[model samples]
Target: MTRLSSPAHLRQVRTGNMHAVLVAMLDGPASRAELAQRTGLTKATVASLVEPLLGQRILAEGAVVNAGRGRPSRPLRFAATGPVAIGAEINVRHLGVTVQRLDASTEFERRIEVDNCRATAADIVTRLADLIRTAIAACGRDPLGIGLAVPGIVQDGAVVHTPNVPSLNGIHLGDQLAAELGRPGTTVAVDNEANLAALAHVWPHRLAGDDFVYVSGDVGIGAGIVIGGAMFRGRSGFAGELGHVIIERTGHPCPCGSRGCVEQYAGLDAIFQAAGKRDLAALLLALDHGDPRALAAVETASAALGAALAALINICDIETVVLGGSYAALFDHIAPGVHTELDTGVLAATRRPIHLTTSAFGRAAVTRGAAALITRRHCLEPNLLLPPGRRQ
Candidate 1:
């Protein structure tokens, strides 16, 4: 006689089936029959799985489609409006928020420039909370969760070390933001800004592959590594510290108390210092005018950046490198130098060419990436749509 399955086992199986159904629709709409075929589940089981999703407004019936011989069927698509995810960022120069639906459609977004380096952690949290509150009001619904991007090492929802924004050091930013918003129950995820920016490239049909390293260029440099379609946070969640990769044994000083780090040579500040530009806008204008000093500065930084990246690629075996943050703006000038360095530095370059590209989102990548983390979780675990007590 066959033994009955335990409740826990049954719940696990059901959750997997639901996830399959949702993932099958990522390309577009699908009927129950199509979903059954794609997910390897019976039509009846597919129907049972979709009912709650439809009822919860997570999925909606689209216009009927006819495949000539078979009966007409209405495809199921993600609802135009449903649970939304909020993404926020705390950068040295800006604070930002973005609200997005499960379909990846942005509902609300705002960014304000500020001298966050000088602001206290409490003041920054207050301003960011107000922005989140405004986004919630504009969306007219409570977000499913919030993802925060900060420029530093993050551990257990707290910012353990942020060299650029020291005020946030050792702060449980996620909990503080949630409490500031008076929604202590809301889930807030905090992570490295570069890591989140890298996620943004992967989810919602942005990046082409599962393995790559995203290097963020700014006042501080960081990298985000993606392998097999998921982030590789390494043990203790402090893996992608690209900025601190020592290129010189005794070069320039770093805020992290390290000397000759890559950031001292390739970070935006270094480039600006070399070019004598006050800011990114001025530097871009100079580059546009074919300014010799600006071009030279970019070349020097690119060489240093390439050396650091070559070492990372050698170890991680990542073939694609996407330059984000301020680097995106300087891509045209920097790519050649970086390519030259990679060709000579990477051992694997003899077998395969490394692909280097610029991020489409530019400075907006971190914020958008923060939002993607929430949407990704919602997609993989649709049970989150159910009431707290009812979720398996």
Candidate 2:
């Protein structure tokens, strides 16, 4: 078998072709010619790559479409039943794990409290793997991969520095979980949870376009940068650190070692503590009843969020900004204030409307994005979640 040569200028040709075809099939079913047209590859070249995928049961061909006068054409599609992928997102006080098919449609999800995320590295990984395994088992599918989304700086697909969860720092989580799971075909990837949430905001819209950003405000605050429709991991692969952006100089202390950082004011733990709540539902109810303390927390968090958005929009100038995570719903209470802040802080106010929206997928955004990552990794390189010209 002749191996495809890596393009001297294109980095890796086989990988590129494989990813392109896989992405196309994941989009739905398409004929070889249609794939060629979509991927800009010759039919012969596409077929060569498609053969191996077919042999591996990764790609399936079915149903002939009569092309007016020619013989029926068999369309290529991805075998969703081939394997399953799991995504685990660990928040400041909760653990969320989800299992979904390779095509990214979720099958089962489980979320529970971990109290203090300050547990030791081994303990966190061990427990997280157990929860993920349970979810995967419930799905009744053979797990093919796992994606871990944690807070802090993720370097080279590992949790390098986690300020929120100190014990997770310096752990090669991807390697550790791969050993623990012991599934021969299972591989693991790790990334910043905020980055994953950001990607979750835009990943589904990639098939349409990739010019958006997601501002994730949960227990902590952070932003995900997507440019040309892909998660833009900067020089260090930890580009979206929106939470730590200094919004105030002397108001509150932040875990990221800064005064008045956005995380300090808008982080969930801080807000919940200030509100003196043991259950989030109770606090939300209090906020609904117009409790002064709850309302104050919401107002303070929203104002800080609005200020952060203003700064982010002014700097990045992306088309759409999505607020995801637990605090996304609070946007309604603060949109007016946010609008005022945006008008004052951003440049050329009228050119791009600065459409601020909340995640349609709600809390499930990150897990869904993890599913999206699985599709991106095992199937295709280009995105396929949204249709072109319809991403908003």
lDDT scores in order: 0.90, 0.72
Point to the candidate with the largest lDDT: 1
Write one digit per residue (lDDT tens) for candidate 2, span 185-205.
566778887778776655434
The reply for model 1, stretches above 4 Å from the true place, is: 1-4, 204-206, 389-392
Q: After superposition, how far is residue 339 of candidate 1 from its true place, in Å?
A: 0.7
Clashes of each: 0, 2
Global local distance difference test of model 1: 0.90
lDDT of 1 at 278: 87
Candidate achieving the largest TM-score: 1
How many clashing pairs in candidate 2? 2
Summarize candidate 1's per-residue lDDT along 272-364 as a digit string, tens digits.
999999899999999999999999999889999999999999998998999999899888988999999999999999999999999988778
